[model samples]
Target: MTTADTPPRTLPSTSDNQLLADAGEGTRVEFRGLVKDYGTTRVLHGLDLDIAPGEFVSLLGPSGCGKTTALRVLAGLEAATEGSVRLGDVDVSRVPTNRRDIGMVFQSYSLFPHLRVLDNVSFGLRRRGMRKKDAARRATDALDLVGLDHLAERFPHQLSGGQQQRVALARALVTEPRVLLLDEPLSALDAKVRVQLRDEIRRIQLRLGITTVFVTHDQEEALAVSDRIAVMERGRIEQVGTPEDLYLRPASATVAAFVGVSSVVPGLAAGDRVEVWGRSLPLHTPGLNGDVEVFLRPENVLLVAPDGPSGIDATVQESTFMGNFRRTLVRTADGALVRVQHAASDHLEYAEGVRIELAVVPVAARARTATA
Candidate 1:
């Protein structure tokens, strides 16, 4: 449902200030066999998720994936076609958006254009029959938490986009939601502002000990902010783990391809061992045989002088100097382009056509070749 259309949700007797300050132990969230369909098009195919109290989770995926739809379901903005959503022990699957006791921040920073920042933040409280004076006071406290108290008197039009988003965040937190849902909340901000605001959001979430579900298509953003990420593909969660789990040990080829800079090289797999680039290596992915492709991140490939017993012969094709790191493109004798990442100051002379040796770290993911 649209922000303007959200049903009246106000706790008349409870002071927003007291509620916020004493926000009870963050509530756990559970999604059991959740499913959503648009006519014949199924968007979520029996999804299951469990979020611990005060845990930070990010639903990460590409566009058209079900991450945002899952968040909307949690917020009670969209009814699940099947399954159940429980907040703590209470099933909120059929709960109205206003009664779900959750707060959401959108990419657009939906602050009312007509109201000052303080009033926009206190709007929810005042609707609950809170005294105007009490709402304003609580709003100021919320603003202060977001580091926007000084901008309380300014209308949304008078503030910067980042400031407006901060106001929206304050508004969300002022209610002390049991669960915070962020739907691409930083997508509209500039790179710098997005980074700054995400950092701020993480800091505040940690300090408040609130359970949060952040939805984003940006892998880097998810990695930076989330304690764990659920990577969605098509209508299902491909994998769910800590940022490092999904990055270093992706459970599927789809996740390996999506999470980071991965280089897929043709190889032969036999049980626990795989041979790639004329060298034998360990395969971490199970149930792979015959011809396969081994995937490894650039950091896992080590470059050295070809004179040693450990290095595979390769020629430098290109090199790009990124701050703090250097990315070099090297082609193997088999015409495979392998990238080597190292310290920018390492000074591995990588001129075009320069012969070099690559020692690949043993751990890699193996995807079975499809027989057509």
Candidate 2:
């Protein structure tokens, strides 16, 4: 494992300072009517999205939802069955992967086992016909951006999983590609290291102002780093919005259920409000009336006094201590189960009787007869 105490073997050259100062906004990326298929299986169905210059966007969904395929299409790794990909103002659908000028970091580190970290990062520059001395300086600068320059002399086997991933990141960025594509790059590491690297990637992307497309199934990771998230399901984008927008105002039932932990409970809808457990809460998008299923977030449900007149009587089934907060599962008298999230200090034991109520907030719901 590499340590911060290890001194960097070389100092940054004058050109390195100029390179760092020249960091500018990245190119815009657009996916227009993108579709993909493997034989008769259509993986992406007319997907469309626009990413602003230097923005960080995440394509988030479950496995086989085509998040990876979408990223690959943009990176020129896979050809779209139909439609085109635009980098800035140019259509690059027919462009080769190497000529597209895009950098990609995959789930695997994909580092050369026998090469030193410095050489591994400089390989792309060397392949592009840069002189060895120039390539080494540029590679060192890239490593410095990721705080890994001190480990340039170490081989891949001498590094930890996180360190290896960082080197892979350096390798990708050494070329200063117009866009950065990350395909669940942190998924292989342990939880703590994953978070650390995830933040590091975001930090580097911001500093370089590189337009980035990240693919991931982890909701927390997406929520923490992305400027906007496009939630995909069944080969199509279900919803696209910021993390708070998706969590608090999901455009569809699929988004509500997929983006966060929502409990689907039966409710009655009338006008702009939904009545869940005898409490009338505002609706996020008011259109449906009559019987409906409300998507209730754990944080939106609150524990009230047992004798509170507006609350429904419930029995606590379980409570999980989640550091800063506590999540407790409760079953109402009518057999509807709900999870309530509250301050960690507000502890409740198993089998304890309590009263719970939904906070007076707008909630997303769909008709009971509606399908996802």
Best by lDDT: 1
Cα miss at 200, model 2 (Å)? 1.3
lDDT of each residue in 168-274, candidate 1, tens digit only: 99999888889999999999888777887887788778767899999999999999999999999998999999999999888888898899887777888898888
lDDT of each: 0.86, 0.84
Kindly report which residue stretches of model 1 are placed more than 4 angstroms away from their true locations once superposed. 1-20, 306-310, 313-317, 352-355, 370-372
Q: How far is candidate 1 from the true structure (C-alpha RMSD, Å)?
A: 6.4
Scored against the true structure, residue 96 in model 2 reaches a CA lDDT of 94
Q: In model 1, which range of ten residues has the least summed lDDT?
A: 1-10
